[model samples]
Target chain A: MSKSVRKKPAAPKKPVAPRKPAAGKKPVAAKKAAAVKAAGMAKQPDIAPLLTVSDIHTYYGDSHVLQGVSLDVKPGECVALLGRNGAGKTTTLRSIVSLTPVRRGHVGFDGLDITHSPTHRIIREGIGYVPEDRGIFSSLSVREHLDIALWAAKKPPERRDEVLKIFPRISERLEHFGQQLSGGEQQMLSIARALLAEPRLLILDEPSEGLAPIIVDEVRDTLARVKKTGTSILLVEQNVAMALALADRVVVLSQGMVQFTGTPAELEAQPDVKDTYLGIA
Target chain B: MTFFLFNLLNGLQLSMLIFLMAIGLTVIFGLMDILNLAHGAFYMAGAYFGYVVFQATGSFWIALAIAPLLPLVLGFLLQYFVLQPLIDRGRSAHLDMALLTFGLLFFTIGLIDLVFFETLGLTFMSIDKPAGLGSYVNIGTFYPSYRLFIIAVGLLVALIVWLLLERTVVGAVVRAGVDDREMVRAMGVNVYVVFASVFALGCGLAGLAGVIAGAELSINITMGVQILIPTLVVVVLGGLGSVKGCFFGSLIVGMTETLSQAYVPALALFATYLILAAMLVFRPQGFFGRTPKSV
Candidate 1:
C-alpha cells in the first residue's frame, strides 16, 4: 500500500526538476553515467540513468528470448532500440514495464529495484507505456480514455486540455469511441494518453508502425516537441530512419542480444553493425 | 388480457431477479476474463445467509441488508487470495480455474444440502413476503405488489448501474480495465484491486438476487443449480462483457421462458437456449459484446 501512496501523482506536465541519482549506489557509476550522458544532453543532472535495465533475460514459454538485454535512458534523452522482426524489441519494453517478467536481471527506476514490481507499481514510479498496439478500448469514448489516463496518473482534470493540445486531432473526436478513430488518430490518442500521466520516463513500443510516411513525420515532430519537455523516452521501432532521426543514442539488437550501442553517427560509420544487424547501410 | 398482464408481471419479476444475477456474472467476466461457474453458489449462499438473518431478526429488510455481505466478502477473498494466485501462476490455465469453480459450485451445493437439508432436516424453505407487499395492487388490474416491487427495483438498479458505468470516472477506470487490462495496469492502475472489487460486487448482487428470489420460490439445495444455466444464457445472450447486453438479454430470456411455461409447457425448459442459439447463429458476440475475443 505504501508503495504507491508514498509518491504524489506527478505534478502537471512540465519539466519538473532534473532527477537526482538514486540513493546508496556507488557514486562512481553515477559519475560515469553523467560523463557518458554529458556528450549528448546538456540539461541532465549528474545522475545514474533515470531508467536502468541490466542483463535482463526474458523468455516466452520455453523459447529463450531476450538473452541478457541491457540499456539505459538518461533524464530527457530519447534512446531508440533498433532491431529486426523477432529481435525482442517490444519484449524489452514489456520487461521494463514488468508486463513480461524478467527471469534474471535488475530493472532499477528512480532509485527503486522494480524488476519484481507489479506493472502498475512500476508505472506508478513515473514510467508511462504506450504499448505496440496503441491499446485503445473500442467501446470507450475518447474522453473516457483521456479521463481514465488522468485518473490513473492522479492528475487534475484541467490537465486534459493541456494534454489534448499535444494531439489536437483527438480533441475533436473526444466523443468518438476508440473503434471510430483512424490509425493515425489512434496513435495520437495512445501518445496523448501516456502523456496525460505526466511520466518521467515514457516507453513507446512502435509509434510509427502501420502509419503512413506523412503521419510518421507528424509523429516524429510531435515526439520532438515532447522531448523538449524533458521526459526520457525509450522508443522501440523497426523504422530505422525515424529511430535514427529522433534518437540521441541507439542500441542495436540481433537474436535477442545487444549488438551495438553508439550515437546515430557512430552506427552510421560502422556499416558492418548497421547493415548486418539493422539492414541499413 | 388480464391473464397476459399477470404473466408479463411474473416474467418481469423473474427478469429483474435474473438481471441482478447476470450483471454480476457479466461484469466479473468482462473485467477479469474469469467465467465464475460458482456464481450460482453465491446466489444460494445468499439465500441461506438471508434465511439465518431473517430467522433471527424476523425482518425481511434486515435479511436483505445483511445477506449480501457474506458473498461480497467471500467473493473478494476468493478472487484476491485464491483465484488471482492461480491466474498469476498459470495464465494459460484459465479454463482450469473455470473447472475448479465448477467443482466449487458443487462443493457449495453439497455444503448447502448438508447444513440446510441433512443436519437441519429441512426439505425446502421460503422467505415470507413483507407486510403490505403480499396483497395484490392495481396496476392494469390487480397485481402482486411484491412482484411489482421487484420489477421496479430491478429497473432502478439497471438505471443506476448504467449511469455509474457510463457517467463516472470510477466507471471509466473499470471499463478501461475491461477493455484492456494490460494497458490499464501500464497506466499505473492496480488492476488486481479492480478485479477483486468487481468480483465482490458481482457476488454481492447474486446474494441480493437470491434474497429477492427467495420470496417467489422455495430455497432448496438444487435452487442455485437450477438458475445457473438461465443466468448463463442471459450473460451469453446479452454479450460477454456488456451491461447493456445483460439488460436486454435478461428481458428477452425472462419473457420467453415465463410466457413459454404458461403458453407452451413443453418448450419452457428450452426457451432460454432458443434465444442463445439464435444469438450465436446470427451474432456470436451477443447484442452488444465486441467481436467475441478469442483470447
Candidate 2:
C-alpha cells in the first residue's frame, strides 16, 4: 500500500501545478482564452481556432518534458508538434489532452477551459487521444474496437462511414484482433478508432513511430485527407520533413521550453534554431 | 449401470452449483483485478437468510427470492463504500482484499453459526417435489424429477448469461473493460458504475446458486469450503475470464469428481486437485479461458 502511494507523488505534483498557471501571471484558463481571442483576430486568420495550448509547462516527476509549450490549430487546420527525441514533443500533445497532467499554463478547446477536466470529460468535449503506444485493446477485434470507441464517443452513423473511407485497410479486416494486425495496420487502426469518435480536436502522439517508411507515408496521406474534411489535428511526430510539408504552423520545444513557434517558411529560414535544438545543420 | 446413471445425474447438479460460484469469481478477478476470498461467505449468507426467511414466513418462494437479492445489495454496498475507497487510494491489492474479505467471511459465517446451529442442514423446506413428477423417470435408466429440475435450471441460467454477454451493447463495453479497464474509463463510461454493477451481478449469482444448491444438497456453514475449492478449480480450468470456458470446465470437474467418488473412493479425496493438476500441465489458463493476462 505504501509503495503504490509513494510511487504516485511525482505523478500528482506535475498535474496540480499545471492545473494552476505557469510562472504566475494569469491563470492558464485566462491565457488560453486570450490565445483563442488572439487567434480569432481577423488579421491572423479567418479559420476558427478549436484549441489553444499556450505557455504550458508540464513535467513527469522532476523531468521537465514540456517547457513553455504553446500551439494552436483552427477548426480545419492541421498543426504538427515537431521536435527531435527528448524535445518534449509528445509531452506537449499529452498536456493538451490532459493525459500527462500539465504543471503550468492552460489548454482551451472549442473555447472551453478544459485544462483541469478529467480525460474522459475532455474526450467527451470532442478531443480524441491517440497515444504513441497505440493503446489498442489487443483482445478485441477491429470491429469490436470501433464498436467500443463509437459507443463511448456516441458519434453519428455518418462518421463511421467517413472513418471507413479514411482507412480502408481496416474495412477489409474488421474481424481481425488488434494484436493480429501488423505494425502499419495497427497504426492505421489506432488512427481509425480515434477518427470514429468524430472529435473536433484530434491529438495524435507519434502516429508514425515503429512503422516502415512506406507505411509512414501512407499514414501521412491519411492524415492529410482527414485534414481536408475540416478536423483540427495536433500531430506529434519526429519525422520533421513530413510535418513541415503538412502542418499549417509548427511548434518546437527544447529542454521543456519553447524555442521556436512559426509557419513552415519562418522555420526553414532559421538555421541556428534548427541546429541548436534539433541538432540539424 | 444404475449406480453409474445416479452418479452422472449427481455430478451434473454439482457442476451446475459450482459454475454459479465460478462465473462470478472469474469475471471479478479478470476485469476488476481484485482478489475476493469472501465470495463463499456471501453464498453462505444467502443460504442462512433463505433459511431464516423460509422459517419465519413458511414460504420457500419468498426466501429464495430474498436470499440472492439481499446479498446483491450487500455486494454493491461493499464495493461502493469499502472497495472503492481502497481502489481510489491504490491500496486495494489482491492480498489486502483477500485478507479483508477473509475477516468478513469469518464474521458472517460465525454469526450464522450462532443464530441457527440446529437448522444448518436444512434444504429447500419451501420447495416440494411436484406431485405427479415426484417418482423416478426412466430414460434408459431411472432418475428423480428434482435432480432433473436442477440440471434444467442450471442450463437455462447459463444460456441467459451467455446471450446477455454476447448480444448486448453493455456486454461489448464489459468485454473491452476486462481487457483494458483504464482505457475503458478514458473512453467515458463511468467505470466505477460498471465495476459496481458487475460486482453486484457476480455476488447475486453466487447467492442464487446457494438458493439452488440448497434445493439439491443440504445447506450448512460447512458448505462454503466444500464448494469453494472445486468452484475455483473449475474457473481456472475453464479460463479465468471466459463464461463459456466456465461452463465446460464445470462439466469436466463435475464428471471427474462424481466418477472418482463412485469408482475409486480412495482417490476421491484428491480427485478434484488431480484434474486441476492435469489441466494446469496441459492448458494452464483453463479449457476455454485465455492465458493469464495483464491488461
Candidate 3:
C-alpha cells in the first residue's frame, strides 16, 4: 500500500449494482441487493414496508383515472413510482392523500385505513403530500408558511428548527414570498414545508419535473439523505435514471395499474420493459 | 353647539348599530362568497322577536337576551334547509341568490307586518336607561349617555373581531379561504364547515344589532331596505372582511351622515348618495379593501 494515499474530501461514489441471485425467484429483493453488492456497494438497511395500496380506484368528476393502482413502500426506504404521461400516477398519489375522491379499494398507511378520511385528517394521521403543482401560498413568506403549516396541523412548535436544517435554502429565503422564488427554489420550499410536517411517509408527486439536471440531482440526494433519517418516501418521477439510481424499489404504473415492481437490477435487465414503457432502450 | 354634540352622539350610536349589521353581511359575503340579501331580514326578525318577548314579559332585559337567539336559530335552519344546497351545487350568483334572499326578506317582513301592523307595535316596550348616566350628559355641551354606551360597545366588538382575525389560526384560515376557497380546501381544510359556522355567526350578529336598534329607535317593516343599503355601503367602504377597515369606514359614514343632517339642511337630502358617489369616484373597492388577486 502507498504510504500517503490522497483522501477525497467527499464520500466516494460506490457502484450501484451487485450480482444476479439464483434463478427462479429466490426473493427478488435479495437477488437485486446481491446484484447491487456485485456492482460494488455496501449492504443497505432492511426497512419495513410502511404503506400498501391495493386496487385503488379514483375519479375526477366523470373522468375514470387510477384504475387499479397498487404499490408498497418499506419504512425508511425510498420507493419511486414511474409512469408515462397521463398514466394516472398523480391521481394515485392524490387518492392516497384523500384529496381525490376515491371510488373503491384501500390505502393503508402506518397500519390504518385512510381511503375514506378527509385530506386534513390524513395529514393529521402522519402523511405529507407535496402536490404536483407545488401548492404554496403566494402571499406568505417562507417563515410564515412554516408558521401556518405547524399551526394548522396542531403540531408542536420546535419542528421549525429541525425543518431549517434540511432546507437551509428556505432558512436563507425566510423573508421571500412563495411567488418570489425561482422554480427550483419553490420546489425546495415545497418539499421543506412537507418535511416540517414530520410525517412518517412523505408522498412527493413529480419533484423533478421541471428543474435543471443539477437541481434534480440535489433533490435526489436530499431524498436519499432524508431516507437515512427514517422518513420513508413515495416518489413519482419522470426521470428514469434518477429513479433507478436513487430508489430502493421501483414501481412502474401504466394506465393506473402496476405494470412492473422490482429492484433496479431487474428493471435494468428487462431491456424490453424499459424500451416499451419509458423509451429508454 | 349643544345641538351639534347631540347629533354627534346620535351619529355614533347609529354607526355602531350599522356596524353590527354590516359585520355579518361582509363576513358571509367575504368568507363564504355567498350573496345574502336576506341578512336584513335577520335584523327585522330580531326587532319583531324582541317586540314579542317584550310583550310576553314586560322586561326589556329579557327581550334583549331572548330576541337575538330566535333569529339566530332561524338563520341556522334557513342555511341548513335552503342556502347551503344552493352554495354547494355551485349555483351561487349575485342576482339569483340576491333575489332568493330578497324574497325571503319580503316574506318575513310581510309576515311581521301582518302580525304587528305597519306602525310600531307593543307600546309598553321601552329600553331602561343606564342609571347614573341618565339620558343626557354635558361634556362642554350635551350628549346622550345611552348613545355613548352603544358607540363604546360597537367599537369594543370591532376590536375583539380584529384580534380574533389577526391573532388566531382559525381566523387566519377564514381570511385565506375568503380570498381563495379552492386553495384553502386543497390544503386539507374543510371549508364547508367554516362557511356554515361563519354564516351563523354573521346572522347572529345581525340579530343582536336588530334588537339594539329596536330599543334605540323605532322598528317598522320599511326599516329593512332603508337600513340595509347604508350598511352595505359601510361594509364596502371598510373593505369586505376587514374589521379595522369596517371600523374606520363606519366612523366616517356615521360622522358625515350626522353632521350633514345637523349643519346642512339642504345637503341632507342628497347626503348619503353624495358620499356614495364620492367614494365610488375615489375608491371603488372601498377605502381599506385591496384589489382582489386573479384566481
Best by DockQ: 1
Report how far off residue B157 is in candidate 1 (Å): 1.3
Pairs with steric clashes in candidate 1 = none
State the weakest 10-residue window (summed lDDT) of model 2 chain A.
A1-10
What are the lDDT figures for the candidates, one per model? 0.83, 0.73, 0.72
Tell me the lDDT of model 1 at A208.
Answer: 96
Tens digits of lDDT, candidate 2, A127-184: 7777787867777788877877787777766677778987888899998987788888
Q: Of the candidates numbered 2 and 3, which has the greater TM-score value?
A: 2
What ranking of all candidate models by DockQ puts the best one first?
1, 2, 3
DockQ of each: 0.46, 0.33, 0.18
Better of 2 and 3 by lDDT: 2
lDDT of 3 by residue, A1-281 (tens): 10111222334333223222225522212111212122211223333236767677887777778877767776666788887898888888888887676798777765566777767777766677777877666655667667667775666878888878887887899888767987788788778877777777888988887899999989888888877777878888898888777786677777777666666666776777677666788
**Candidate 3 error regions (>4 Å):** A1-59, A65-74, A82-87, A104-113, A138-144, A168-189, A208-219, A237-245, A249-281, B1-12, B49-107, B110-129, B132-134, B139-141, B182-193, B248-295
Model 1 misplaced regions, further than 4 Å: A1-18, A21-46, B91-94, B292-295
Which run of 10 residues does model 2 chain B get worst, by summed lDDT? B121-130
TM-score of each: 0.92, 0.81, 0.74
Worst 10 residues of 3 chain A by lDDT: A1-10
